[model samples]
Target: MKILVGIDTGVNTGFAVAVDEGKGGDLIQVISLTITQAMARVIELCELYSKSQVYLYIEDPRKRTWFTGGREKAQGVGSVKRDAQIWENWCKENKIKYTLVHPKDNCTKYKSDTFKKVTGWMGRTNEHARDAAMLVHRRSVRA
Candidate 1:
């Protein structure tokens, strides 16, 4: 069996794990972490799943359009970008094979209403965690 690890990189990082079952994937766990803790957590998971090949899928932070009236949003976006660069560098250094999953490619269900409809109004523990799970779910054979 192989494990698929999905990540949502943002202010509050999200990570989820799923391993392939004979029929599809088995959703396992989800957690939220700080930017500083993200890389270490992934490495920990990789070590834990040593018997299974691990593939990571991280959501590429889409370009956020900042209001022309305020620079705050721009600064926030800058921070997110820096964090992403750190993740990329860590992955390269560790030789971890990974994929970047774009927001659009997953589906148009990110919005609350759309997500509610698709998930039967299921409330998630954390939005970032939900995003990570959804990303992993997208690559599931049953998806």
Candidate 2:
């Protein structure tokens, strides 16, 4: 059994875990968390599925394109990178086999529809989870 975990990190981080049960089988679980709760939630998920071979894929922080606001706004909005850094460090410390996935090479660049047809996921809500699942799908090149 192989377990692949995908994460779309940001202020509202998204995660998707895909379990391969052989012969085109996929069991996916999804979650969304605030920046503060992100690390703990991921750790909890890891523990629950610890028995299987696991790989964690997290979306790298995107560079801010337009910070039109003043210094205060810039400082406040910079939480995205800061959170990614925190999670990256935390993941490394935990000794989980992890990969930092860039948005350009994966679903973030194209759109959520990239994996909709292929994955066993339903509905259009919670794209964070959807992107996470897609990351798992493209783990080979992106990871």
Candidate 3:
């Protein structure tokens, strides 16, 4: 079994957990929560699946050079980048393997219907969760 986790770190963080059992069996779970809550969930899941091959992927906000949005957007971007850094540090400290993925690499932004169609995830989800889910969706697709 392979456990794949994807995170969109920001003020409203997103967490997606995908479990892949060989032979074309898989499960996906996604949710939007506060940054702290999301991190706790990630840690819990990692611990629970300690024996399995777990891979964590977080959106790297540090790749952005500039932002056009005003103060609010800039503040949000700053928060995201900071959170991403913290997540990276946490992964290193815990010796958990992880990957910092660029936002452009996963195509996070998707409409509700399109997201459901693309990922075959029917659960209710917010923008952040959708983005996070998309990060791991690629892994499931490949599997």
Root-mean-square deviation of every model: 3.9, 4.2, 2.6
Q: In terms of TM-score, which candidate is strongest? A: 3
Cα lDDT tens digits, model 2, 56-98, are 7777755435556898777755766676677778777887777
Distance from true position, residue 55, model 2, in Å?
1.3
Better of 1 and 2 by lDDT: 1
Error of 3 at 75 (Å): 1.2
Q: Please report, as a residue range, the 10-residue window in candidate 2 with the lowest summed lDDT.
A: 134-143
Q: Give stretches of model 3 more than 4 Å off.
A: 22-27, 140-143
What lDDT does candidate 2 reach at residue 21? 51
Stronger candidate by TM-score (1 vs 2): 1
Mind giving the per-residue lDDT tens digits that candidate 3 earns over 1-143? Answer: 77888899987888888876654324378889888887787778777888236778899989867678899888888889999999999888878778899877888789899998888888899999988887777574242
- Say which prediction, candidate 2 or candidate 3, comes out ahead on lDDT: 3
Task: Report the number of backbone clashes for model 2.
Answer: 0
True lDDT of residue 61, candidate 3: 85
Tell me the deviation in Å of residue 39 in model 2.
2.9
Q: Candidate 1, residue 16: CA error in Å? A: 1.1
